[model samples]
Target chain A: MRGVVLHGPGDVRVEDRADPRIVQPTDAIIRVTAACVCGSDLWPYRGVDKSDEPAPMGHEYVGVVEQVGDQVKTIKAGDFVVGSFFASDNTCEICQAGYQSRCVHAELIGAIGTQAQYARIPLADGTLVATPGPPDAGLVPSLLTASDVLGTGWFGAVAAEAGPGKTVAVVGDGAVGLLGVLAARQLGAERIVVFSRHADRQELATEFGATDILTERGDQGVTQLKELTGGLGAHSVIEAVGTQQSMMQAIRSTRPGGHVGYVGVAHGVALPGEELFFSGVHLHGGPAPVRRFLPELIGLIWDRTIDPGKVFDLELPLEEAAEGYRAMDERRAIKTLLRP
Target chain B: MRGVVLHGPGDVRVEDRADPRIVQPTDAIIRVTAACVCGSDLWPYRGVDKSDEPAPMGHEYVGVVEQVGDQVKTIKAGDFVVGSFFASDNTCEICQAGYQSRCVHAELIGAIGTQAQYARIPLADGTLVATPGPPDAGLVPSLLTASDVLGTGWFGAVAAEAGPGKTVAVVGDGAVGLLGVLAARQLGAERIVVFSRHADRQELATEFGATDILTERGDQGVTQLKELTGGLGAHSVIEAVGTQQSMMQAIRSTRPGGHVGYVGVAHGVALPGEELFFSGVHLHGGPAPVRRFLPELIGLIWDRTIDPGKVFDLELPLEEAAEGYRAMDERRAIKTLLRP
Candidate 1:
């Protein structure tokens, strides 16, 4: 089976790899139907994070189960499925508390690589959610999004406590940030503001229910958001950029007693406890428990209630995986989908 | 009127000052019946905080209303009242959201010096909570405790979400931290663990309802707490010390999905964003909205349901304000009450 591997920085290549087989009694062999390059993939691609060897490249996928081990019960062979980036044993105390990312028996699918023809998914019954049937071609990107971004965005909105009559401010314009606007809207937020400088991303933000867009950064961004909310700042803030500046902006953009749901993969950031204490905002975030939201997100996508698939700007055959990585790393595409 | 003033580091003096008069339409002049030195007062007394000149000291007090401004309606002259350290209008949007500490018309009573024989309280109608009648002489200490420490401790417990069947870990041995144990017990917490090494403070903590006492500090304290909670950490952590180490211990001691309510006045602490983000715990704290809990705390005191007055270990006339400061500064007394 051919899969994507990164031997070193700026060295993504397609190579023939051993086909994955069910190992654990709870594992399932998934034949990749579609997968995509995630924003987080750029961490190593840009040389910001080091790679020791030829490591697996992808975690997001919409696949069809080709085989299942003896213990797998909820899913069967030939079932079309969407699974989270992290495989969790959903029955753990942590998973029962809706934090599957912190599940006692959790595994990162990225470690095994999903950008391949076949992959073994551990804890199949807990990690994978099946689609109603063979999904239509148009639903592929949306279902694949349920594997990570959509569920992540939904988690951000929920963490921010965005709901009826609340004003939500989003700090990034990436696919997850854009989808967060949609999630906040669906959660009944009356005012949605997206911080973005790009014209194209701003338009998509507006389309996704951002009531306003601020083309400012840091303090100026906080000022603009506060001015729009009667100088009290937004009631909820979703931080999708994990930089120190973005985190501070998100914290400052929220009013006292507000909530900040930050889902960005943190990089080189430290939050000042004094500032947060004075801000009087409730803060909670981490690698989102996407598995917790997968069922709902998959239901919403299958019913065509939300169009998260719009985030994908480029699509190609699995053989052209390098181009997909290049396009995203160079910011030429918001996301890329690869058909196997 | 005689007041407590800090001329310089270790230079507390009892000096005659001008009698306070109503300065705002919502202000009231109070004849202080009792006042006390706070843990935060030690900051400047020990020279950790700079003071260019003699500065007014003390913010916690219970007093008799001597005069009321025209706009004051809820409180009147001759009313015995227990007011929060920070006076808030309590009708603003922030106050309505239960964060009266950030009220638009909030005033720090310490600035005006509640340690004086006569003091002016701003936003009197919103700041002062009247007792059913004149408090008994024996209840004076409890009422004074409500003015700051007890209220702050209660806020910490509530912020940490201490409740039935929850395990609560308190991370300070100060008056507020000790009272937090009492508050957690009152709130129905099943297990209360207090981190204290001082024999006196630990004894008081146990008396207040601490089910366990961990004498360790820092990482070791967290390890002990985790070991006590089946290796998952406590369900709620109350941070009563405003230092980086205490804050981190409070954060580390809590399980994922737990809450941390910190009430200590933050001095110079910064939290690492990446660690906090990955910790997966809810964080909320600041200058507590003591006014929001005053009525309940007062009722608890009135009914003899809790005896928070035990925190006061020394009593002195207002004229011996210098000795009171010295006693607290030397750790010779847990707290010193001044009678004016």
Candidate 2:
């Protein structure tokens, strides 16, 4: 099987690798139809996160079940399925409480890498959601996004309590943030404000339901957000960029008693306790329980109620994995979808 | 008139002062009957919060309305009232959303020194909640607690979502934390756990409905809490101590989908964003909006349903305000009440 592997900083390669097998009775092997490079993958590719050894790369995938372990009762071969980054039992107390990402028996499927011709999924019934049937080729990209980015953005919107009567502000213009705008709009937010400097991202954000766009960054961005919301700041703020400046801006861009739903993977961010306390905002976020929202998101995609696939601005073949990583890293693409 | 003043760190004195007079159309002057030394007061008294001048001290007060400005409509002279530290207009959007402490017209009543014979309260109609009538002397202390400590604890419990079937853990055993245990009990928590090292405070916590007591601090306390909660951590955790260790312990003690409501005045605390993000817990707190809970708290106190005054184990006359501060700062008294 061919898979994407990271050898070192600025290095991504597609190489022959041993095929994944069912190691647990609850596992299922799937022939991946589509996989993509995630924003988080850039952490290692850019050397922000050091890797001591060669590491497998993608976590988002759509595939057809090729084999199922004996204990797998709900999932079977020949089914089209989508799964998120983390494999959870989906029945643990935490999972039942809607935090499957932190389930007691959780495993990071990203460690095995979904960017391969075939992948093994554990807790098959809990982690993978099967489509009604084989999805149309045109629906593959949207279905693939339900695996992580779309689910994550949906979770961020829900965590921020975005709904009718809410003025929601998004702090990033990446795929997750753009989708967060879509999620917020779908969730009925009265107004959506996005901070973006790129014209392309701004246009896409507008199409996705952003009513206001600010080119400012940091304190200036927060000021613009507050001005747009009548000096009280937005009622709901989505933080999709994991940086000190972005986090603080998101926090500051919310009104007192508002909510901040942050989904970006944190990197060296230390929140000042005094400012957070005085901000009087509810803070909730983390590795999103993408599994919890997979079923509904799949339905939305199947019904064409949303066009999340538009986030993938570039597409490449599995053998061009290195180019995909470079395009995203250099800001040439919002996201890159690779066919296996 | 006489008031308590902080000359510098470790320097408190009772001295003659000008009697307060209404300065705004919405202000009212009150004859303070009771004032208390709060745990937060110890910060400035112990040099954790520096002072530049002889600042008037005391924010919590139970008093009788001495006079009302012409525009004051809700409160009248001769009325017995209870007010929190911050005087809020109570009609702002923020106040309407149950965050009166951060109201647009909020004024710190402590700046005028409620420990004095007469103090001016801004936003009189919104800040002062009148009792049924002049209460018996025996109920004064309890009523005083409602002004700040009890209301703060109630807010913490509410923020943590303490209710039926929830397991609650309290960090810190000060007046606020002990009352948080009481609040959790009133909210029908299935079990209450409190972290405390002092025997006296521990006994008070148990009396206030702590089902479990762990005389451990920091990580050890968190470990004990998890062990007691079936290794999943408490569903709700109250953080009443504003320190890094206590904040981290509170976050670590809560389950992934749980809530942490912190009320202590934060000092020199920086929350590592990565840890907080991965913790997957909801964090909400800051200066509690005591005014939001005053009406209900006053009713409970009036009915003798809760005896929060027990936290004031030591009492002193107005002339001994310095001693009250000393006793509380040295931990010799859980709380010290002063009669002016």
Candidate 3:
């Protein structure tokens, strides 16, 4: 099987690797139809998150099930499905409470590297949701996003309590942020504001239901968000960037008693306890329980109710996996899709 | 008039000061019937929170309305009332959203020194909640607790979503933390766990409905809490201590998808964002919006449903204000009641 591997910082390669086998009775092997580079992947690519050895690359994918372990009752071979980046038993207390990403017996699918011709999925019945049938080729990218980004963005919106009568502000212009704007709109938010400095991203954000766009960052962006909401700040804020500045901005741009839902993979951010305490905002977010929302999101995608696939601006063949990483890292692509 | 003043760290004195008068058209002057030393007072008394001048001390009080400015509508002279430490014009959006402490025109009543013979309360109509009538002398301490500690603890419980079938854990054994246990019980929590090192405080916590008592402090405390909750952690955690250890303990003790409500006045706490993010817990708290819960708390106190006054283990005349401070500072008293 051909798969993507990271040899070191900024060193991505597509090479032949041994095929994955069913290691557990709850596992299933899937022939990946498509895979994509994610914002989190850039963490190690930029050497911000270190690795001791060569590590497998992607976590998001859309694929057709090729084989299933004996104990995997709900999933079977030849079924087209999407699974969360984290494989959870879904029946654990945490997963039942809607925190599958933190399930007691969770596994990061990234370790299996979905950016390959075939991948093994654990907790098959709990992690993967099969579509009604094979999705249209045109809907593959959108279905792929439901594996992570779309579900993550939706979780951010829900955590922020974005709904009718809410003025939601999103901080970040990445695929997750843009999709968060769409999620907020779909959740019935009265107004959506997104902070973006790029023309292309801003336009996409606007199209995804952002009623207001600020080309500023940090304090200035918070000021504008507050000004737009009558000096009270937005009712909900979605922080899709994990930088210290972005976290603080998200916290500051929310009105007292509002909520902040942050989904960005935090690095060196240290929140000032005093400011957070005084902010009087509810803070809730982490690795999203993407598994929890997979079914509904797949339904939405199947019916063409949302167009999250538009986030993938660059597409490449599996052999050009390095180019896919380069484009996303250099901001040339909002997200990149690679056909396997 | 006489008032308690902090000349510097460890230097508390009872001194002659000018009596408070109505300063705003919406203000009311009150003859303080009872004032109590608070855990927050120890911050400055211990020199952890520095000040440039001999600041008047005290914010929690139950009093009789002495006079009202022309525009003061809800409160009248001769009426007995209990008000929050932060005066807010409750009509503002933030206040209406139940975050009166962060109202656009908030005024910290502590600045006017409720520990004095007379204190001026701004936003009288919004901040002061009148009792059914003048209460018996025995109820004074309890009503005073409502002005701060009781209301703060209740807010913590409410913010943590303490209710039926929920396992609630309280971190901190101060008056507020003890009251939080009471609040959780009243809110129908299935089980209550309190972390306390002192025998006296632990006994009080048990009386306040604590079902489990852990004398451990930091990591050990969290471990015991997890062990008690089947290793999943408590469903709701009330954090009433603002130090780094207590904050981290509170966060670590809550299960993923659980809630942490913190109300202690933060001093020098900085939350590690990455840890908080991956913790997958909902965090909501700050200077509690005591005014929002004042009416309910006062009613409970009046009906004898809760005896928060028991927390005031020491009583001192106005002239012995320094001794009252010393007793609370040295942990000789859980709280001290001062009569002017």
Which parts of model 3 are misplaced by more than 4 Å? Answer: none
| Candidate 1, superposed: residue stretches over 4 Å from native | none
RMSD of 2: 0.9
lDDT accuracy of residue A41 in candidate 3 = 96
Supply the TM-score of chain A against the true chain A for every candidate structure.
Answer: 0.98, 0.99, 0.99
Ranking by lDDT: 3, 2, 1
What TM-score results for chain B when candidate 2 is compared with the true chain B? 0.99
**Candidate 2 chain B: worst-modelled 10 consecutive residues by lDDT:** B109-118
Model 2 residue A64 lDDT score: 97
Instruction: Give the least accurate 10-residue stretch of model 1 chain B, judged by summed lDDT.
Output: B265-274
Best by lDDT: 3
Candidate 3 per-residue lDDT, tens place, B1-340, comes to 9999999999999999998887789999999999988999999999999999999999998889989999988899999999999999999999999999999999997887888898999999999999999999888889999999999999999999999999999999999999999999999999999999999999999998999999898999999999999899999999999999999999999999999999987878999999999999999999989999999888898899999888989999988989998998889999999999
Could you tell me the lDDT of residue B311 within candidate 1? 95
Query: DockQ (Cα-based) per candidate?
Result: 0.76, 0.91, 0.91
lDDT against the true structure, per candidate, is 0.92, 0.93, 0.94
**Native contacts conserved, per model:** 0.71, 0.91, 0.95
